[model samples]
Target chain A: MDLIQKGKNYLLEDNFQIRASDNYVNIVSYDKMIHFDNKEVKIQYRNKVITVIGDKLVVSKLVSDEVLVCGMIQKIEFR
Target chain B: MKHYIEVRIEGKNIYRFLKRLNQAKINLYHIRYHGINQAYIKILKEDYEKIQDLKTIYDIKITNWYGIEKGKKIIFKYRFFLLFFLFGLALFIFLSHIVFDVEVVHNDKKLRLLLQEELKKYGISKYHFKKNYDEINKIKKEILYRYRNNIEWLEIKEVGVKYVVRVEERIISKEKEKRPIQNIVSKHNAIILSIDAEEGEIIKNINDYVKPGDVIISGEILLNDKIQKRVSAKGKVYGEVWYKTTVEYPLFYQEQKITGKTKKGWSLSLLNKRIELFSFSPFRHKKIFSKPILKSNLLPISLNYERQKELLIIEEALTKEEALEKAISYARDKIQKSLLEKEKIIDIKKLKVDQNNSKIIVELFVTVYQQIGMEKKIEEIKKDVRDH
Candidate 1:
């Protein structure tokens, strides 16, 4: 759980490599895979927490050597 | 706060690149695959700048984002028109059902009546909906086939759901043959005033006295004193005759003075039903009297009514002179109805009188023209026409 929290925090606070788009985004990852169904999008490390708003979040351990915060879907936000 | 950016590609290998992006944890919505080499895609707005950097990596072109904006507007715009069109269509269907007419025709009257009963059974009467045309047509065909021999033509037509049927009747015409004539004679002792002949001939001459059923003219025609051809002859003959009579009156009588007062009221009754026109009252003196005059005609639309009333009167004793004068007037009126045509009163003379305790019986002899029993027969004459 701590590692999951650590990975979530890393994706939210740290600026990872991503390709921004109108409906979706592509990201590279170097961590264990993380899955979420458009909910519980948070990473808390000590007293610092990183929050992301989207439909889903994912983590993948790949040779890219970077934590990929994929699934940057448009989160529902009201004005 | 993610803003989606839409992308359109106008080059080859676009699908392959899109699949690569999906594998890299990219989600897409409102994505349309135009063809094998072309595609349009929408992505998060925050990733807009990053996807623009990959423009050099893939041969992609971002065309105008008109399709998405137009699609969103279309959803709301057509909602108004769709509801209005449905409302109009429903109203038209309802009104069409209300005013549609239906008719049925058959050559045979028996078959026509039978079909009418069947149509009524199926709720297809004079006023029926056109939308029910198909069902009604099926029913009509079944009926026609049932009476195929009786019906020559069967058609079901609809003009905006109205139907009309006309029928023809087959029959033969025949002329009426003549029947043997029975001479129409006067029931009373009256001259043949006039005759309205439908088909007959007249043979009796004027002033010829006729008896009942005596052949004044024969319907059997005779030529040169021998029967030749037959035709009915018809006409009327008026004959001058005489009748006389005298009435006797009493010399003493009680008369009532007329006060000339009346009460008016009306009553109604059903046809052939008897109803009393006035209510009877049991009161007053025993000598008081009332009279009823009944008058009824076919034109008034009423069965009948009686006009009855009691006359206010005072009883009075008659003098000898007044009694004699009244008796003479009564006798004159009696002979007036019995007088015949051209009959003159030859003389009137008092004969005798006999007096009782309170009344005097007076008699007279008045003479007038009269024809004694001379029976004349009305013969039926028959004529032969050249047209035959």
Candidate 2:
């Protein structure tokens, strides 16, 4: 990519920015959402899995480059 | 900072639908799960039509709008109502400030007419709007200054879209001591029509030609060719006067007539440049008249309304007789403007006619019945006699 193109696409990278809290979890640069339900939300980044297990889980904001999951977050596991 | 629309999607396995939307590179916001197969999400406003183009089993219902688009949506929905309200407000302001009638309160009909004419010259006439209170006061001061000799005081009072004018006439105390000797003279050379004398001896009989400045009513009372007493002449004389004029009119006439079809529309004006808004297709040949609907003092923007009227032209070739008649009436109108309301043309005669290649010229001799009395002081007559 050109210099300007690389700078504009800063959010679309190989890694992810995962910020988890007691009530919510925000993830940036997630590749895809593999599974979604009220109880669990599983996302992938470069063949790795990040599962968010909680009650009444909701993807409050969703995009290809960023995702914000807001709920009563109980556990976050990366595999 | 992007505008969005809140939509609810309902179908079997809406999770797969969200995945399908993401694969299509569409962004969704605030995805709240309502059931196992339904959810509420926000998408970019421009992406709304793209979502409809996907054409799936999902039922997408728009619930609300977000960001700047929300304000625009509300405005578009109630545009007609807003337009009506603004027009009504402008009409109220235009009606309240307009001068509908002017009334001069006086017992003397002549003084009242003189004052009304003076008021008309100062922009206090009917159906005119003003700029500011200071300007109206300035106009009032101007009228009072000009009439300071004829009137002692003049007051213009505005009462509910009308002007009530009150005036006091200037009367000199020295002139009221005795009978000021005066004579009534003819203002124009004319044949006397009638004489109604209340205080003077009539010197000119009916059908007698009296020239300008000639004494028609003498202040001297004569008995057997000798003056016995002198008094002021107080009377009215009606005379027949003549005026000669020529008027030219085209023999082949193309008259432009108004079709009476009118359409009203709004426009925006900045300085001298005007842009019409909400206007329909105009007539092929038309005239536009505009008034301000919304005006701002601080900004140069003003909303004005333009009324367009259709015009139609009819061509005809007049005969010699018809053209002559037209020229005669045209000459009468030219002379009628200089006459008072009570004075009018009594007779019109065609003196001569000169026809050209494309035009016809007619000369007319017109007669009018008018008041020909002008008061003159007897001292001027005595001075003339001593000088001669």
Candidate 3:
């Protein structure tokens, strides 16, 4: 009905999304984050799980539905 | 939505504070670990306000603000300077298009005043907006047409912030048919060499000697010793005229030689007073060249450059031959200027040369063949006859 609601509906179509680069990690439409530390972070969305392992891991941006992580990222696993 | 503010958090468990902020759905960016018990993080303004509820768990303080808010503060501080700069620019643009002076370029006082008045009627006076080329041309045509008899040609030119109007006056020549009967008389005492009559009868022949005011051609037409009609006399009468001239020349002359020493300086001249902008010259004699910074006649400001040159005055004596030649040529030139354009120097003879203490004086007699006829109105002749 409104512009903001329409945009939210489009972004939330996917249950969860994970994008990782050399120094940054972005998670979109995630339900919640389970564990976070300097070496590893675990996020939960729908019926799946996402884990990120890096050195000096810092949460740069955190919102209701999106998360941005920045560090010397080493590996990322999903289940 | 991304209004960032640097916040310093002081607590033993910084990680716990960060995790709580993340769980609260606050957007955080650029989080840095300052020390074991303190950390710095950038967050949105809205999120920072919401995080105040957790002040009991952690000590929080905002260190700095960034982005658009900082730019707004700086602009507000220097608002006066910005307004003054804009006002100055507007004034400069407005003044550049205004005419400060209107100059009518003419030698006659009456014509200059007439043109000035005419231009004023067209709104082209001082402090008025300068007209474009097309408007100036239209105004020129209108003025010329209004005073067709008085003005033969007109032009308007823009120089700097001034307008220059140039005009030429029309002169009406008198018609010859309306003039009275006249005779061609001798203007000088000379012997007639030849004659060419255009509208009059030749009265004098070649080799005939005539005095001043004597008639060389007659305006009266005769038929069998009877007066028929009268007309204006016109003719050219060539004759041999003589002149005697004397000239004196100095034997010794003093000349200046430049020593090539020069000094450059600037000066400003206003009316009759001049102020030097640079240092004064040590040399006594110098030449000055000035160029105006503002090329307007109403503004008397200019930049003057003075060049000082050293002069050496030396006296030199002329030889006898040189002195005699100088005196002779001076006398001849003086006599030659009085002759007509078609005249030629028939003979030149030296009468005498008197050498004084410092100068030589020469006297010469020159003979030239030239036109010696001039018109005399019949009414003037009748007045002279009645007086006699």
Candidate 4:
């Protein structure tokens, strides 16, 4: 149809989004938090699972956009 | 906008509680984990109940609070003190603009009473609201103008809540003080008609002719033509004096008598142009007495009360004899006004009369008996006993 409608459909339709920086990770459209601890946090969206491994990792902010984990982030693994 | 607060949540399943909070659309900020099971998070104050409902599944304890709720609790705790402080500040501002007492600085009781009355009329009395600088200056000017002969200088000073009025009385300077040992000299070359001496020896008798500067009443108390003591010569020495006056009388006289019907109204004047308000019935011949109500110093515009009194004019064609009699009376009045209260007019002799155009000019010699005593200090001769 139109470009704006296509963009709205893209935003509304089920899609997983993740942003990771040196100190924090922001995730959007996640199903739930599978596990959370001092050293790592695991989140699952649809049929996929995302793993965040870090030191002193904590959920700094949370909204409908899943969670934002902040700390010394070493690596992120998705399966 | 909802106010958010930072609270510490203590529970065994803290992570599960955060997940449930996010699912409920409750936003959290600045989260920190003290331990694995205990975490601190920020949430909106209204959403605290949802977190409380999860207490059955987990043991939830609130450790601290923050933001708008914290501020509201602190304000509610000291609301009474804040109210009293605000009320006190408002009262201070109101009391500063009120006058509690008026103090008039003067020694004379009558003068103080008069000034107080004048100040009361100008709205500067006790318990009145304080006036600004310009208004006070205007009031001072009005009072000075109303009592110009009574007050020479006036000052209105404000000290805290009191109005202190300082005034100076206008004392009319009288004649210079007479010496203790002085003589009353004849002021003019006349015949002394009467003498009333309060102190001193009478040197000249009644009906005696005297010249100017001649001592009529002496201060020296003499016994057998020898001086004993001296005193001030205080008395009224009545003498007959003459005046040569020429008065011009009109052949036709028009006397204006006020009918006593006076009308007072407002008048606005711009420069030399005046406009009277509510002047439906006008007086044909009127004498207007006006006092300014509002005057502009910068512009030539003023508003004043115009008190107009109706004048009744009586016109009469005078004959030669009537004109001459009127002229003699006018001359007698002129000389009589110059005399004191006790002084009397003895006679008026017409010397000459001449008709000029529409009037007659009469030359008259007027005789008035008045006090002619003027004090003259005596020169005392000091003969030193050591020189003798």
Candidate 5:
């Protein structure tokens, strides 16, 4: 059981995972949301920055390890 | 995990408050801003307690409880109605399996009563719970086997909530003809035309004129002129018989004619009572035909259709020839009904014709070739011999 848990942790070693679709954006293991508004959302994870630009963007779900952004997504950028 | 509370946070810095709540690891869902200063958020009931620290920074109030808590509240409020609905459903299911009526279909009263008793012995009477198909079939076999000599076939059918038992009774054929000491006597005053003796001596010859009581066939058997034995006499004796019949007919006859006016209606028949479901017939003179629509065999209720047709009555005068022909045919029909199976009319002659006020009366003599023999017991003949 210990070996299985360590292997699972290694497979999920990525600090932040970002997924974007036609109308929504989902980010997992994000450090914090630096900016959130109607037009854009800026998120910070580890040492990288992720930005989501959309219209009428709303935070549909916000939890400890993940956030779900919904509504009319236009672009996404990572730096 | 499913219980939730809708909280409305009213403050100038609601976004900052949301960020702070997210930092505090508070899960929020379905977050919507009502205006610039007020926003609504749904959170788990357990997580709602953690938002107490934000009371100093923003005003938070629980608007409503949802999910399982809301369902529990509504159920508690209408508990009596739910209980009654469940009880009614259970009663309906239970009553559907009960047999309200048992019907034994038979024309003979004694047989019907016997079958009813037999069915009762198997607990298949009224007010009993209906048995399943396999059990009913088993009971049917058992009963049929018990009365195999009397019952030809048996069937138990369920119609709605009633059980209808249809039974076919065994028909035993008649026993063979018994030969007793008997004699064949003339049934009418006639002249014997032919005689064929099958089991006895022919006492009367052809062209013999005899009365109703004359013996046509003798049951006595003789050897050397002594009565050796006596047997029942069986013979076919054909004779020429005469009948006088009088028939009368009015010159004017009234007949009913259909006028083609029709009306259709429906009725409900329960037991021996009938209730009309539609309007009655408007025509005064009409013929009515009723037919029942059977929805189920177990239920006594049935829908019936009644069709009524209007008729017209008309009178017409008959001619002389028509009146005589009609009178003769009416007389012939009356005589035909009384004739035996092998008897036939040979000839008819008009004896007299007379006319009264408005009717004509015709008298005729009809000749018929008929079996004129009938059996007479031989014991009566022996009694006469002993008395003499």
Candidate 6:
């Protein structure tokens, strides 16, 4: 597991999870790191996530890993 | 430390940037804005390093400026003094008019009125201001020279805009006294004391009382009731007149120094001033008469400096011997003043001075020399009134 999964597993042991479709890190289930090639993508680490809608950055919850960028909408890819 | 940098941000960005800069402890000494947009900021050298990093946050521009703040302050200070100096100068120029005083002096009212009218013609009147001194002086000189024979001297001096014209007039003695030639007659029934006769016939004896209007010395002589010759009946009749003069004793005489033993100074009429026989005294105990001048009296002028004298002021004290002699002398003088033709004193028999209640009362007994009597007769003069 990556450092992101390690921080997420630590939260999962305390009944925490990361939700992808809602663009947030919550207590849903253990989810792997989902990287996207689209410009609008949600980045998750530990029990928190941030969605970058174009160049604008938005944080969904209080977490150690959060970053968002929102501007011109362009292509996106997951990693 | 980061290198220093300056920033010129939009006007709307100043509030946010200044707040952030202040939170970061960036010292801003001088801050100025131009056209409501660009702001020049001066910061401490320590804060310059960190402020340069905020370029990405604020559009920053660097510009070098000289010390314009201190220069503006100095200019304001000098401008203030210049304004005050100008105000004071204007005030001084404004108050240079307005006559301070007007003085008029003259012996004759008619002359004063004439002079006043003449002065009015030359724009000189009471309460007038804005008078030109040189022009007034020239005008005054012209007028005075036109009447040089009448006017003695005149001068006009100016203090501020007020003028003082002092004048002096020529002296003109213009009076004559006339004496009447009349016959001398006895005023009452009395004994003849003494007589100094010019030309007259004696008729009565001494220690004899004569009737009123009775001729003490006759102008004409008569033998057996017939008129003989005519003569001038001129003589002084003096009698033993009783007088009681009371003078307060311990007269508490007070005298001040009159003549200063130094070079003359500005005169004061009171004590500490002396009148040389030539110079006139300004003050007198009494005034007998004053003659005024025409046109000169209205100009604060004096025609003459005649000194008046009063006998009440005693310059020197009288000793015991001097007092007795003076008493007799004063009695003699009184008798002489009362007589028509001058006569001498024959006797001062009784003189007693008694001090009572801070006073000395003197009673003098006197007998004077005079003509003895009058020859009573009227001679008829032949006057032919045929010539029309």
Instruction: State the DockQ of every prediction.
Output: 0.03, 0.42, 0.39, 0.40, 0.45, 0.01
Write out the backbone clash pairs for model 5.
none
Winner of 3 and 5 under TM-score: 5
Report the candidate with higher DockQ, 2 versus 5.
Answer: 5
TM-score of chain A of each: 0.33, 0.79, 0.79, 0.82, 0.80, 0.26
Leading candidate by lDDT: 5
Sorted by TM-score (best first), the order is: 4, 5, 2, 3, 1, 6
lDDT of each: 0.50, 0.84, 0.82, 0.85, 0.86, 0.51
What is the DockQ ranking, best to worst?
5, 2, 4, 3, 1, 6
Q: In candidate 3, which residue pairs clash?
A: A60-B28
lDDT (Cα, tens digit) per residue for candidate 6, span A27-48: 2332322332224454444555
* TM-score to native of every candidate shown: 0.33, 0.49, 0.47, 0.50, 0.49, 0.26
- Ten consecutive residues with minimal summed lDDT in candidate 1 chain B? B377-386
Per-residue CA lDDT of model 3 for B1-388, tens digit only, reads 5677888999878777777887887766767777657878888887888889865668899876779966765677778987888898898878878899999998999999988988999989999988888899899999999999899999898889898888899887756557569999999999999898998788799999999889989898888988688988898999999888777889997778887876666677777787777564455544555555543467766666655556767877998679888777776676678666888888888899888999988888878898999999978987988998
lDDT of 2 by residue, B236-311 (tens): 9989998887888999999899999988888899988978786668677778898988899999999988888999
Which residue runs of candidate 6 sit more than 4 Å off their true CA positions?
Answer: A1-79, B1-84, B101-127, B133-150, B159-164, B183-388
- Model 5 Cα lDDT, one tens digit per residue, A1-79: 9898778766874446778889999898898888787788888987888989989888877877778898899989898
Question: Which CAPRI tier for candidate 4?
Answer: acceptable
DockQ of candidate 4 is 0.40
Model 6 clash tally?
A: 43
Candidate 3's DockQ is 0.39
Candidate with best DockQ? 5
> Fraction of true inter-chain Cα contacts (below 8 Å) kept per model?
0.00, 0.73, 0.67, 0.73, 0.70, 0.00
List where candidate 5 sits over 4 angstroms from the true fold.
A1-14, A19-25, A33-35, A39-55, A71-79, B1-14, B29-42, B52-82, B176-388
* Alpha-carbon shift of residue B14 in model 6 (angstroms): 22
Per residue, candidate 1 scores C-alpha lDDT tens digits across B1-388 of: 4455567755556544554554454554545555455666766544455556655556555443344554655666797887888899998877777635655665466766766776667666666544365785787777667766555555656656566565443344456765444443433344543444443445655455565444544455666788665554444433333334334444445455444444443344446553545546621322223232443565333433334344544555666556656776787666767766644455566676656665555667665434322223223222312232
lDDT of 5 by residue, B12-125 (tens): 877778888888889887788876678889899888878987656688898888988888877888999989999999998889989998899989889889888988888888
